[model samples]
Target chain A: MKTIQAVSYPVHFQDKAYKELSSLITKNGYSTIFILVDENTFEHCYPKFIPNLDSEKRIEVIEIESGEINKNIETCIGVWNAITELGGDRKSLLITLGGGVITDLGGFVASCFKRGIDFVNIPTTLLSMVDASVGGKTGVDLGVLKNQIGLFSNPEMVIVDVDFLTTVTEREIKSGMAEIIKYGVTYDIKLFKEIKKNKGLHINDLIFRSIEIKNEVVLQDPKEKNLRKILNFGHTIGHAIESFYLESEDKKNLTHGEAIAIGMVCESYISNKLLNFPETKLNEIKEVVLSIYDRINLLKEDFAGIMELLKHDKKNVNGQVNFVLLNDYENHKLDCKVTEDLIVDSMEFYNF
Target chain B: MKTIQAVSYPVHFQDKAYKELSSLITKNGYSTIFILVDENTFEHCYPKFIPNLDSEKRIEVIEIESGEINKNIETCIGVWNAITELGGDRKSLLITLGGGVITDLGGFVASCFKRGIDFVNIPTTLLSMVDASVGGKTGVDLGVLKNQIGLFSNPEMVIVDVDFLTTVTEREIKSGMAEIIKYGVTYDIKLFKEIKKNKGLHINDLIFRSIEIKNEVVLQDPKEKNLRKILNFGHTIGHAIESFYLESEDKKNLTHGEAIAIGMVCESYISNKLLNFPETKLNEIKEVVLSIYDRINLLKEDFAGIMELLKHDKKNVNGQVNFVLLNDYENHKLDCKVTEDLIVDSMEFYNF
Candidate 1:
């Protein structure tokens, strides 16, 4: 048992948490174990990772489509039926080993079986391990809408093994960085400065730091009532931008974090513009965000379409768009009322 | 505000709760409050029921195709996007005014809005108020499977107005009774005896009794860990039968409780063979179940299809078909397992 105090969950981190998890599983004497992975993770990874576990614990593998398109009622049924067909019961444990899609959908299936059973998570991607793994948000997408269906459920235990990132591509690596950067922008100015200064820093150490930042934010408010909304900082437009790109066949998706990366820049600039911060700091922010994220090109017309999509964004309360603005960065969240005009201006500035 | 203390979530069910709900929405407050009604309930009822609420609430009535076919992800997205275009948000509350489908889909949409807001359930049909209302098993169907994708979360409040049943058809009324009968067969012997005697039972009293049974089961295991599986008594095969007929263009679905009604009869026979259930008591159950549910004609070959569909039922763990067999009519529960052969025989016997 990897203990998470004042918590309903357990997680394994650093270099030692894996051995602790192995012994803990042995101590509990799990009759059998199953692993849920996506097609990408199963093919590229797992073969090398399998030998680390004891052969006596029965291991079965199940795979699904690796992206948001497959995250639906069809996939959930496929998983539930597959697990049950495989002889899964309350005693059977699930080991989710993939990115956000795998962990989110796996946790959801485990939560609903005969009411529910227990499942363990081994987030292979940095975005999942650092952000989605801790919050207990498990669900599927609702058509074009992202995470339009899900619940707050903590995993039984989490194994944040950096070894899984071996298969993650360069694009995926940057997507994960989007969220790591958000933590610095949202909560810790020191962490922000460090990330800014990480010219020669190993990405692995930054991954650990990112996970710690997420863990701290989630523990303070597990359910996301007040302090938690701060996490939505870039999501208002970030999500809208993602959905907009997702609709265009020729356009590329901004990974969960990358979209939020743009959201952070735009929202941060809004903070400066609306709150009248020093113009030099705004220029510093532009340089900082652009340095991390390559130039994103969107036409002025495209920005108008993005604003139209924003009307459908879920963050709106009674039809007005709500933005989680920052106060000099560290204070994290100041809910700002955003109009279409300001949003358009931010989009132009983002690409410029 | 409603004081409902079943087992886990204790709330004082009174006018005060409604008042608090009403006070919270003083403005035209919503773009429009939508009350989902079915064909059966709209013509037979709901006209007179609208007067009880504040006339200023700007309630809009939307009706959809009733029965299991409507509970699809396609329909969910339609309803969701429709609500969004109608200006729904964190402030708008979806009032599911009918049976399980309305509440289930409506709750799903509300829960997904900006990562969930609030939705109250006013269960018009008898089956919903007692069963579907209490347990937060909300989701839609995927292709031919049932509840293929969804989440578990309680409604903001549940309004159990027994008077709503006046609009229910005799067959619809009987369908809800199938579950009420189940509450007795699985947990309470006296409640079982009460149904056996066929005494002067008022609608209000029956609803209360059913709610009490659900409350007991839910309170002890709100998240459905151990004790909650008892509720799936007939649901294992029941859902299979319902899904089979539901998918067939030539067939009509048995109402949810009705499908489980047949499911109960067959699963009970399995309990008799696998769990050493007394034949005399099983006959008593058959007698009561048949009285409450209209007999349906099913082909002998349908058992093969039904059992095959049971493979997809979320209730099963690891492909091994797990049955919630009766330990004796009063305590149906976990630790119950039946061979696939026994499950086949039980389905065949119910048909012949």
Candidate 2:
């Protein structure tokens, strides 16, 4: 297990991670240590994480409810009040020990607590490890909108221990694979091939490679001014879909990965039409993505709601909905705009 | 009027300030310019501010109600939702025009909106001009606790136009004088002499000198790690007093400057007792502070609530309540802890 060097911090893998975390704890000499977790992580991950002996500082655990719906300012208020009541101060250290929801919310809590305190990310779920935790993007969804409130605040270190992944279900792993597939399509065809060939077999190798690709993209443009827009490849339409399902009373909420998986297929169809994306490659991407993810039947009526939400996407600048389109594997075009009709056609293609 | 160079941005005065702002707006070519204001600023400051012909970018006004009590996460969610609803994107520039409340709340709002947007602080009130808008510290209160939730985020530029002070109340002007008085006590005795000699007549000189002293300290320590804590000399107890009065229903909330005036008096007494501070100097300091401000009668019953609130002060690092104490004018100590009995005695002295 090698340490992946980030912009300012290090990302340590399995065995070395605990040692690094312990050393950081002793070195920083924080007034107190507060670990942020959800119910799921508290039940499964915290037990395993606590045994790795660290320091003498008093450690307090703050837990929020599990789920994406809880990832909002209301939840943040609860956690902020909890930290204040728990005697957490400017010198305190917050360790996020769950999936993306915990890390995203916890990272934001630490960043804004007393005008920024130190924090570490110990991403337990596959989605968090590969996508959410590594990048300095810590935020919560606004209403039904995804990641509408947040900032780019890096953690002390990211400890990626595969041991936590044992508790994650197969569905969660596949959800994470959507991002891995994104990396393959946008940055590296090798990654796309690896996931397509082995499915989710080499979990460790896939996670490491996906993180490296994300790190490279983030390092070039941490603030997402230009180069970083490509990472929003599936996110534009995916987030709208995610928000739509979550907001709809009748529809079952789709996981972040599930929504993105459908988005990748729809976007690929759009790319095939506009960018001369090879039809053969589009079918290959669609088949492989659908093989791993259940083909969601997006109703015609749902299109209006999702389209309305798309107008509020964070990536939009100057009233234009921007999408990251690809010509082929590993070749992404930034700031590409498609018409509503083309978008509808792509959604229809996904349903078919 | 000279432009005071900050760590990254410039603090432009009256005439030059508007020019700098107009140029910034033109150069950045922001997608939309959102002006955040309170009801007071919307009524008084916005009309004067808008005539200073700026860019053709779409300008949107986001009005929050005036008062420190409204500075909380709830207000932030409303502003964030409004920004989303009003077509505010990443390329949006937020111009906070009002007192400390607007700048502090608006700065935090802009920083967290779309993971940070460009923001300019136009401090309309005396309190904001000298202290809040200049410093990179932006935040909202949590349950009567002042600045309990926030982060250190600098604005693009700060426009200190004293012409807007015509709209400010005498009491509000006196409130801002607290921080100016704090500058004299902590950083420069010359500032103390000027204020005492002129008695608020020389407003322009006072604001500039206060900003200079504050900028110097902030430059040395932007994050309030070491030397910057000196700025908190009167703040530790001052904020507790402010929070105490704000929370008490029967009592009228003391303005920020008024609470700090009481705090300076109380803290000076503590310095005289613990730090072997000169007795005559402490009396002189007390007289100068009391001359411009009305002394509030604090009851013995109020001591417990004030003391309890002191424990939750943002300046505290460890479990101990930290105070920034001064030996004499321009000579201060950081991270100094005093007995709870002594704190109670200081309150008694303020009453006396």
Measured by DockQ, the strongest candidate is 2
Model 2 chain B worst lDDT window (10 residues) = B193-202
lDDT of 2 by residue, B1-352 (tens): 6888888899999887888888998898899899998888899888998998467878889998888779989999999999988988989999999988889999999999989999999999898999986669999998877788898899999999899999988988888998998999788998888888887467998899989989998999888788998888777788898888888899988898888888888899999999988889889888998789877899998899998889888777786888888888899887788999998898888887
lDDT against the true structure, each candidate: 0.73, 0.88
Worst 10 residues of 2 chain A by lDDT: A193-202
- Which interface RMSD values do the candidates have, in the order shown? 3.8, 0.9
Which ranges in model 2 have alpha carbons more than 4 Å from their true place?
none
Residue A269, model 1: lDDT of 74
Prediction 1 global C-alpha lDDT:
0.73
Q: lDDT tens string, model 1, B166-222?
A: 777777777788788888888887777887786467766777778878887887887
Error of 1 at B345 (Å): 7.4
Model 1: CAPRI class? acceptable
